[model samples]
Target chain A: MVSLQAAVESAAPVSRLHERASFDPADFPVPGGREEEWRFTPLRRLRRLHADGPLDAGKAGVEADAGPEITVVAAEHGDPRLGTAFVPADRVSARAFASFREATIVTIPGGVAAERPVVIRVRGEDAGQAAAGHVLVEAGANSSAVVVLEHAGSATYADNVEFLVGDGARLDVVSVQDWARDAVHLSHHHAVLGKDATFTHMAVTLGGDLVRLAPSVRYAGPGGNAELRGIYFADSGQHLEHRLFVDHARPDCRSRVTYKGALRGDGAHTVWIGDVVIRPEATGTDTYEANRNLVLTDGARADSVPNLEILTGEVVRAGHASASGRLEDEHLFYLTARGIPVEEARRLIIRGFFAELIGQIAADQVRAKVTAAIEAELDAMARAEGGAR
Target chain B: MSTLEIRGLHVSVAAQAGESREILRGVDLTVTAGQTHAIMGPNGSGKSTLAYSIAGHPKYRVTSGSVTLDGRDVLAMSVDERARAGLFLAMQYPVEVPGVTVSNFLRTAVTAVRGEAPKLREFVREMNGAMAALSIDPSFAQRNLNEGFSGGEKKRHEILQLQMLNPKIAILDETDSGLDIDALKVVSAGINAYRQSPDHGVLLITHYTRILRYVRPDFVHVFVGGRIVAEGGPELADELEASGYERFLAMEGAPA
Candidate 1:
């Protein structure tokens, strides 16, 4: 019989387990949809960004805004600071790394706290051509900053984002993928935290035809803390997937992952996978991960999986939970019985389901924008589903 | 003054294998303005069913009966419509709506009932007054509605809504089931304070007469086997408390 340790080890893909990180596109092979990581993704809709497809020469529309305490520069791909945080793990990221002409590097000086966030907006111009881009946000020692990356418009895009947080630093990153319905995007977010550093990353995926985001974290030293939070809404014919990996290679580190999603309409689907591993030598690690999905209408599907693997017995805590379900009947009754109309009650519950997570967002504008987008989505869902009532 | 009249109310709940079982079998009662009606019964005596059926819970279907609030066909109204028409039920077990704060829910409820959103200052003052009367911490208003609340906290929150909504008719379904003596006294005082107005009516359903000792009922009903077997004044409550529900269950042949 295979041992429990072997079984647990086999649950996650070996490719991701000993992740091959390189900036060379030749180091990765094109997936055939049979690989565990690509099994759930629809490859045909990716517009050949996965293989030898030519990447557009022109950069996607890009804009950056930051306070005086930070610097934003578009340097060539050979910039020494470009890939300091992480190497390209998959084919798309490697392709983006190699094909992109220039990469945006945002740097905050050590010990200087930024009053405002470093905001970067990437707007895709065409759905007919595939595009590639890259961004790196670097926080020096004892520095505190917030960085937001907003993606919009319609195009087939692949990119990578690196966050390097220094010792005793604080970094909050909010990446929003609110594209047109015809857009197809794949992204990789890599973060490295130093001693006593704190990092938080929020991914709000609202409008995309097929969006897959992979975010992974690695600690450079002990006393590092990372929180990865995400929210997504999938309408008809849309696919949204978020996969996270938290690698605890150091002692006395902590990680928490929480993601919530809602699906409505036929063929609307969402997938959330949280993988956490505590190395044998990494004792005193505290971690918890959870994913909750709300299926609002017929013909919608959600798949949630949480994989927690521990090689050492000495741990502060380690746990995971995942659930996908419809709204409770009694929840509706409770709301309506309080004089909220049926439609309004359903909306309120859906909003309430997301409020707690959204409230934790540090940036006020992103939070308000996400809330308004959710309200609009709810309005459209009501208009479509209200006929039955 | 409003009147809630239930004439020959029969309610059946959906059960296993597509079959519906009758819970309230021809329950007839009238709760008028300025009166407190106590519905005392055993665990399976269906008194709670009577309360929910009148409140338009979709789970309990009304069959061959009529429930009217001030001559309006309450059975025909939706759950929210009934609430908008000044009907409220303090459930034995309130639902826990995560992320929906007590303050937000109360404001939404008050807005829906009053046909307009109250000004921020006015609403905060009103909520503060009601919460203070219930002895709830000011921070309690910011907590999610009934989420992680204790039994006493949930009951007190129900009464807080009762005060804020200021409904014409209130149905207390086993509100005193899970309360300590001190909480019971506080809840009773809240009910008594709300009942000081002659225009409000109350239908208190419970299994014991412990709460009736504090909030005396104008009418006492002994509910058993889906129907009221006896009705009288406060003396009936004392009699039942002294003798327990044994005699009534024996009379109904409810497998005692």
Candidate 2:
């Protein structure tokens, strides 16, 4: 095992967070290339960030806005936990603290359903360094709220968010990871669900030099449910990866995940990994995971892996499926025969693929905003690839 | 004169490089404006191939033939271009587009066919009237194109598109399949409404004669072994429905 100090020394970019004292990349064990979980992932992307510059918080203008009733928690020296437990003092604490140095947290009181969305806007300043943040959402019992985390910046940055859902509570978290063209983004979101609690998380990754997001959910109580949906599109030289893990710890819990991605242009690689685990005590647990990828160009690549681990013999249902391929020519011909231009037809097909995920949004305003953002991203990508030729 | 004329039409299916199998077999048919022609046929009679070939499906190769819509060379254009040239095919299996709403698709199709943007109010009114005439729910306008739709709903949507686009020539392939009597009545009523246009021509293809009773056709052609072996008035459909395609198959010496 490599020590935090030694790992930081080995990875140059890890030195930038040294000042914050909470986020030490070296603390987290690097998965060997042989690990089953990291088998398909290109770990080289992380190694590249090793030599990057320290994140300049001043240059990376990350802003947070909350409703009047909501409380804003800032990352100050005294507030060490950042609203959630800073686990494994050397591991996530350093990263949480480094993020806390400028991170903002929003809290919705018990039984309060906020009409306005809590928006966290992150803008990067430099292209070399990375910036991360910790989002701690504690929805009290029977409470419901919506949070929108928007990532838009000119520089490269790494973002981390951890959420906790209370018993019988509901939380809707929508994340827009739209960064600069030359920036690299690595985001990890871990969620813990309580009894009868509901958690809905959606991610739209449209912009980044290289982007990777891992969203994991653990149902700790019986009858808990989690819905995870994601949409990503990558064009020319862009890499977008999403990995999801659903852990069912108790009986009668349900988990559903569906992710769709579209890749275009040369060297565009998009990956999806879905893992579901049903513990011994989690009998009668119902879980389904599916990932679908569409390759829109000759050189674009998509990799999908769906894995399920069932330890309970009494499990009711556990299934996983993965598919990756080029767009169906017959479907294209069908659309074109209706007089739709090829470009517009592609847009329709792509939009249709992500529509089911977007429709799951509970808030109309947030749904519309997300839809518009997706459209803008698609248009920009289409124009960029169109102009390249 | 409004007419879709196929003169010595020769079509083939591309099997491999420079390898094509003749399918249409030099078939000839004329559908003048203001007339509905029912092409009744058994399986593999090139009925669908002819329809798809006419609609410019790239898979269907027309080795030697001329398909002219109102004297315009349709075979020379692309599928969508032919649609803009006033041709429409109500697909037998309507493709389901999960995210596109019926109204958006209809608006786009109507705009493309008309070569102009349709005013929202007028388009909505027109669509609403059509849906009402077909006894369709107004909420259907916001649903995704044929996504999660019932069999009858899909057929109704096809006719809805036809009523909205109002093309010069419409080819409906197996539009009567999977439809109940009430739905069949609604679909026939929609087609009947479009038949009032003197410039409109319809070629309805079906395996059954149930729909012809509702929307009477001027001419009926029995397609067997990739050729139209028999032709007559509306009574021919009743005759075929009674005796089945056995007589036609016997006449052509082909297995039924």
Candidate 3:
């Protein structure tokens, strides 16, 4: 007997009342790399994803499984919540939204607390191929759950993810972009929070030739809170970018964003852009954002920009900070003065710089994996320098 | 018996990118083992520069000087090399090292100096004893190294390190600048305890003679315009406190 889930996923498109997102791929114009959002990105290296390139069906595959209380369904076009939070904000995301065949919807019933996290694994098995994907996550009122979107393997992929958090619910979404060395990834994630909801979104970007992720948030009612935290490391010839936006539309809402990155080796680059908008009606809103980057080697580059737009002065607190610098001379001096060698001192400082954020990962295995990845990046740079010498 | 001998020492510091200014001029001093020397001077007289130059601080450049520790060229050593070569400097403004606990820093320093990691039990026992002797609270072991420590606490921590590392020569740069009487007595006791070693030497650089009353240097040198203008015994320190640097400043036609 064929499984019920497989039949549903392969069935004809589901009928709904909402208008379908244009799948023409030509609906979005090609970005010229001169736009403010695209200025720091290298458009010529995108492998033609910006110019209506075909998304190979077998390039990247998705396999999602979840706890017993959550229902997983294959949603077709015209599903209202499919594109509700996740509107294609850019050309690549628009192309991804337009070309995807079916979207996956994962729903958690009201007040049902899952004992384990919902794990969605997306693995790329082919090189020089591009694929598009979409996932919609909904948590009903008073429920609490964690959804982990784990990406690994090869292929150039573009995808859009959405989160609809219900009132009084708590939801944590961790999206890890751990692609292969030759792969390229561009993803957009949007979360719409309900009244009195608590939402947390974390992005851990470690691998990929060029990975650009944009995660945004919007609140439906007051008393909502959202936190966006991310960590990334770019090695030689790697480009990693994370751009986040938090829109405070409801009064008494709160939001926070913190992203830290380290770069080493020649042509290793990272970009973090945090934009927070507090509307005039968003009185009593409290928001803060901070971005810090540590450039380990000589040729690495990091660009951090934190923008805050407050339409009214009635907010509780709003502030933003961005800092990028190499290893501090004083810190090195302090360490070396005690007899630790220069290389060991640097390793210790970098470890300490990332310890705060790494400790925040609730998952033990992921935290260990991230720490190991950082160590590996450092060791790779050391090996490269040794080889050059 | 070893000695740290400095003769005709001259040093310059870069005021900016291109310009250099001389801070130490024609100073001569000898610190033999089992002796303590106090170099007292007014602000901006280059007392701290001498301490840093001997410690090989990158900010201070020795233009024409010879610093020899037991016939080894101290001037040719890097900061860490100088530290490993049995020379230590207790800075006035100890840098704050975040995310490094005091216990870890001390253990690492000791390991580096001894060229091997110490046994955990022995290291912990020694650390506890040193902390107790310096009157450091037990919680300080877990705190980040000098990150948020008070002035007195920093001085005590420095002495704690001096005791733990046990360098052949120790230079206390303005160690008594920001301390209460009780703290001064405690720190002085720690230094005196280290001075009990027959092969250890102490160099105290201070603006006030207040700490000298507790540590009691064997020799006192009055510094003016980056050089020692007057050298005498402990009586010189008493005279400087009683009469101030007016007589010495006027001896060189310098402003007091």
Clashes per candidate, residues 3 or more apart or on different chains: 0, 5, 0
Off by over 4 Å in 3: A1-27, A64-81, A101-104, A112-117, B251-256
lDDT for each residue of candidate 2 in A59-102, tens digit (9 for 90 to 100): 56767787887787766535654535323222323443454455
Q: Which stretches of candidate 1 lie over 4 Å from their true place?
A: A1-18, A387-389, B253-256
Alpha-carbon deviation at A67 in model 3, angstroms: 4.5
Q: Which candidate ranks first by DockQ, i.e. highest?
A: 1
Evaluated with TM-score, which candidate comes out highest? 1
Local accuracy of candidate 1 as per-residue lDDT tens digits, A1-389: 11236533443433354367777889889999998778888899888889888886534888899998799999896888888778887899889888887788899999989999889999988878888888988999999998999999987889889999999999999999999999989999999999999999999999989999999999999999999999999999999999899988899999999999999999998989888888776789999999999999889999887887776667898888899999989999998898989888888889999998899787899999999999999989998976756
Judge the docking of candidate 1 as incorrect, acceptable, medium or high.
medium
lDDT of candidate 1 vs native?
A: 0.90
TM-score of chain A of each: 0.95, 0.84, 0.91
Chain A TM-score of model 2 versus the true structure? Answer: 0.84
Q: B147-240, model 1: which lDDT tens digit per residue?
A: 9999999999999999999999999999999899999999999999988899999999999899998998999999999998889999999998
| Residue A3 displacement (Å), model 1 | 12
Q: Each prediction's interface RMSD? A: 0.7, 1.5, 1.5
* DockQ ranking, best first: 1, 3, 2
**What is the DockQ score of candidate 1, to 2 decimals?**
0.80
